[model samples]
Target: MSKGVITVTDAEFETEVLTTDLPVLVYFWASWCGPCRLMSPLINLAATKYSDRLKVVKMEIDPNPLTVKQYQVEGVPALRLIKDNALLASSEGVIGKDKLLSFLDEHLNSN
Candidate 1:
């Protein structure tokens, strides 16, 4: 866990994410993925920028197979916006900073 971002595991997923009061941005990534590494800073920036309104978390796919399977994550660097235990939006791959922020704003603004 770093600043606004919390690293979650299979055991903690339900309690930390599904049960949270705010909308959660679940960042699904793998250590070996280049894009995952490249998107790290952007993810951190999002966590800090949206700290007041969003709960950001990172889950490594290799160590958290149960959650990965549950989320149906087919690739590293995947993002899932969840609120009230429901999936609101999903994006895979490196979508850059502008797109990432807009993605959040688009869905979050409505709710």
Candidate 2:
């Protein structure tokens, strides 16, 4: 697990993400996915940057089938912004640092 990110499983998803007071950025990924590997550092940076306002978690899709299916995550390197137990936004593929931060800010700033 990264310094600022928490690794979550299907069993812990509800408690770790949905019930938390702050917004959560769920990073859905797979070990074998090349792009997922590329996004790891960016996710970690986002976690540190938004430490006060958001909770960042990583979920490995293979083992976390329940959450992956529930979230309708069709691919690896997926991101879901969850706040107040609801899905605020979702993105898939490898996104750059600036775009990732902007994506988070867009939703986080409004609420």
The sequence of per-residue lDDT tens digits that candidate 2 reaches over residues 55-75 is 999999998889999999998
Q: What clash pairs does model 1 have?
A: none
Worst 10 residues of 1 by lDDT: 1-10
Candidate 2 Cα deviation (angstroms), residue 12: 0.5
**Model 2, residue pairs in steric clash:** none
Q: Candidate 2: what lDDT?
A: 0.93
lDDT of each: 0.93, 0.93
Worst 10 residues of 2 by lDDT: 1-10
Q: TM-score each candidate.
A: 0.96, 0.96
